[model samples]
Target: MTLAGTLRPQYDCVVVGAGVLGLFTAHHLAQRLDPRRILVLDRGYLSAGASGRNGGGVRQQWEATATIRLAREAVAVYRRFPREFGYNPWFRQGGYLFLAFSEEEAGRLRKVSGVVRSEGLPVRWLEPHAIQRRVPALSTEGLVGATYLSSDGVIFPFPVLWGLYQDLRRRGVEVRTRTEVLGLSREGPQWSVGTSRGTVRTARVLNAAGGWSRDLSALAGLAVPNTPTRHEILATEPVKPFLDPMVVTLRRGLYLSQSMRGEIIGGFSLEHPGEGTSTMPSSSLFLREMSAQMARLFPPLASLRVLRSWAGFYDETPDGFPILGEDPRAPGFFHGNGFGGHGFMLAPAAAPRLASLLLGERTDLDDRLFGPGRFLGTKAARPVEGLTLG
Candidate 1:
């Protein structure tokens, strides 16, 4: 829905997408510049995209140092969000457990756990007995060991998005939902953005449109190597809260967590034909596979009924990391997409860091790590294969 403010012909900055990234980016921009000069445009209602469709998982466990740091900072912000914004995101520090069933998987976890520990995070290597003790419902057959991060947790995403949206509105930032960006072009020093509603001219534009980011970048004559893949998730009927921590099977790329409302919320990736973006009717394949995996892992959940299932797109990059920073060809355009499956978790820190970069402020995160320039190189084309554990 459009706000009461008059639509300006031009703005200092126009942020595309009203998801968590866009909302947080606009909020941070308001803090750095005049709030009235910033405008946020979304194709659909706020939180209608992947931001609201995720499984509400957050974790600081990552093999990359840059991602680990960003996640740590993001979790800290999530912990304080409820008190600071007067909105309960239902933040739960139930921890994240990554199970390794094979020697190869165990080795990978060991190596990554080293990096996690080096970053000063509390990560533990749990034996099968310890793993079984922690989650008695899980089957330990062929399970080598697991990595547990006590501080990693989950938070309800919609409240966080709503909180930011309300805060930005109160700070004078104009947020317009159902405003789709049709085209983007550089006109002298400013950008002329053609939208479904109307054309807007802005000195800078932040492309935070998630899965639609590749198309948005193409509109500016920039070809990004990001692909949108459908990821499916489901929730079961509310049962007694038995699962405290989110569990991930590293081998199968499966994960599940019992929410505060007692519904088991989770998803997993199966070998698809690498299909392009299509978030539609949930697949029976995903439901069957996920159910089988869940039942095998946690036998007690075998009889539980699934309430509903839905699909969302993952803006995946070759390196399994997000592409951030400004477009080299388009001077005023910036990127905040290709987050693979961890965009929601990284939003808290990534948005502010992106805003800092946009406003020319010093940031702790080095832009080179997430820069789009990496994709042009031979070494960066190699995929880091692993399921995002959160």
Candidate 2:
């Protein structure tokens, strides 16, 4: 497993997580500097956090214009990720179907359809019959309509991580596993990171530590307004390939996507926000909620035997959107966490823009809305409504 020399206690940049955001930040930095100057430190195996554990749902149907843009751009990168990283990420372009149970929900989705079409995405509004035809097993009892995105799809999370990790290593970026970051300090123009393995110095640091990002910001004397809420997802026994597009019900906060292996994998939102980062055994309440919601939308899954379930934290923000860009208090320390539930779909697009900003390049995308200053005293200059993804 030794791909390069041991850490030398110093580097040009040190990223403190190997999750999607951290890996992409380090990879983007390596694109800007010598590979030897970049280092990625992770506390667990690559993709072991929310990155690998997430439901791998990628879609462009968002209420916020910025969220839409981020997701649209990320989809492009994800389409080309396999060739760029030399491994197919199993990114299936099966599209996404968003079902509505009420006229209000249907009307809101109709508006979102206009936004999606205006943004040049391949989305269309479908009546209940169309949804029933596309997904024969779904129950259309109370359903009114749906927003269908032909370009939306799901990817297996592990191969994407493998491709990113191997690609970074091949470029001479040092990634250390099982290396927990204990502390950090600023020294003149550089930052010193104290870890369980040893200390390392870097000119800049990116805090892409997924669920632990808020804690890392505190170490730099920055109060980040974020909380890690736990979400659980379960799989059903392998079945025939009946479901194609991912089925989502925004009203119920329910989403279900079938894996390549035919296991229907998904979950529903909790009534209250989750507590800490414990990914303990799945509870009966979770199964009950998921089963009830699934039956209400897709009646076919009601009898599907549950295979297994797992949990991961949703690093949530006040607005249920991500907080991206450089830290206002600590310029050299950057942040790219708090995607709420869509970090994986936004990382590819966000990473390159962040890299361009760090290197003083001009980007057409303005990221001030996502800066750390927004949470301090500045309110969101623009109002974002509809489908906040809980």
Candidate 3:
């Protein structure tokens, strides 16, 4: 499984970044194109980026129509991963409960629930008492109401990445790790991708670099509006299985869910101190904020010892949605970054659509919503607020 052999000088398509999105795109491309013609390159090892550092939460509940549809389809793909790829990601369907502590927040949740239900998703309005019934550990003192979607849940990310990587290798797709894409230049119809290892001439290049996608796009002389920000998460020591559904507090931007190993794993959005892409170090500020919020919601968790803390970058966009489709400035360049925090959940559905576009096939999902041209004033940008879920 080593890429020690002499590298091919050319490829039909060179996918940058071997994260879930890039791997899945390569997987789907193998179905239509020759596997040998497709290549995946990453700056680090597989799943070493945001793809491996996430909480693995998957949900269909979204504020935007396109995002909701994408999530629903992704959940289906996640459920079939074990059988399709021979790797179980431990996809749990315990559901997601968004808690609201104020009337304004509850109203927004109700509106979103209505929209989600109208779109044929199984969502229900939960009063404070009903929410308390589902999780007796939660404090309902100031909770106004909540929205529950039973189908939304979580999955183990490592197994998914491993499954995709193994399957891609089995299909003869070249996946080279630690191969940083240094520069991209267009010579006629081919794209010259300069890497740390060597130069690869590719017909098309897909920017799936996650947090570093914007920087990768810049190498091609393309300016994308995506910003990479650091997000932190921590886990507690394994305890008894008590929390069933992933709980999200909309007010404080806190979300938590118990893993299969019985550890409470989650994170919260804080007033980030640093600007732009800086050091991704976990702050005591996050720990203090998370602890206070968790204790307020669930008092017993205060006693549980925090195992460890880590931070990862989130490729955020102004619209808080992903940037997809081929770049207008760079002919053979495609953008698939700016997923914010939901890239892992949306990758399954997004990858196929992106591949379809690359292969010139009619895709079911609307590609325009995520196209990079929107920020260029070619299309209107419909920003999805209150959907990042941190």
Q: Which candidate leads in TM-score?
A: 3
Could you give candidate 1's per-residue lDDT for residues 1-390 as a string of tens digits?
464445789899999889889898888899989999999998788987899899888988888888899889999999999897879999899899999999999999999899899999979999999998998888998899999999999889989998998899889988998777888889898999998877889989998989888888998889999888777899999998788898987765788898888999989876556565544458899999899989988888999999999988778887777877777777889999988778888988999889987876677765556876766656643445254643
In terms of lDDT, model 3 sits at: 0.88
Model 1 off-target regions past 4 Å? 1-6, 377-390
Where does candidate 2 stray beyond 4 Å?
A: 1-6, 271-274, 278-281, 360-362, 379-382
**Candidate 2 residue-wise lDDT, 1-390, digit = tens:** 243355787788888889988888778888789988887888878877889888899889987677789888888988998888888888888999988889988888988888888888879988988888898888889888999998888988888888888989889988988887888888887888888777889878888888888888888778898888777888989888988898888775789988989998998787445455644446788988887887767776778898988778778887666777777777678777887778888888888876766665766554555765677765645454346562
What lDDT, from 0 to 1, does candidate 1 have? 0.85
Q: Which residue segments of model 3 deviate by more than 4 Å?
A: 1-3, 273-278, 378-385
- CA lDDT, every model vs. true structure: 0.85, 0.81, 0.88
Query: How many steric overlaps are in each model, in order?
Result: 0, 0, 0
Candidate 1: count the clashes. 0
- Residue pair clashes in candidate 3: none
List all candidate RMSDs to the true structure.
1.8, 2.0, 1.5
What count of clashes does model 3 give?
0
lDDT of 3 by residue, 1-390 (tens): 455665689999999999999999999999989999998998789988899899899988888888888999999999999999999999999999999888888889898898799889989999988988999999998999889999999899999999999999999999999788999999998999998888989889999999898889889988889888888999999999998899998875799999999999999877575566546779998998898889989998888889999988889998777888888887888887898899999999999999987876676655556777878865554655457874
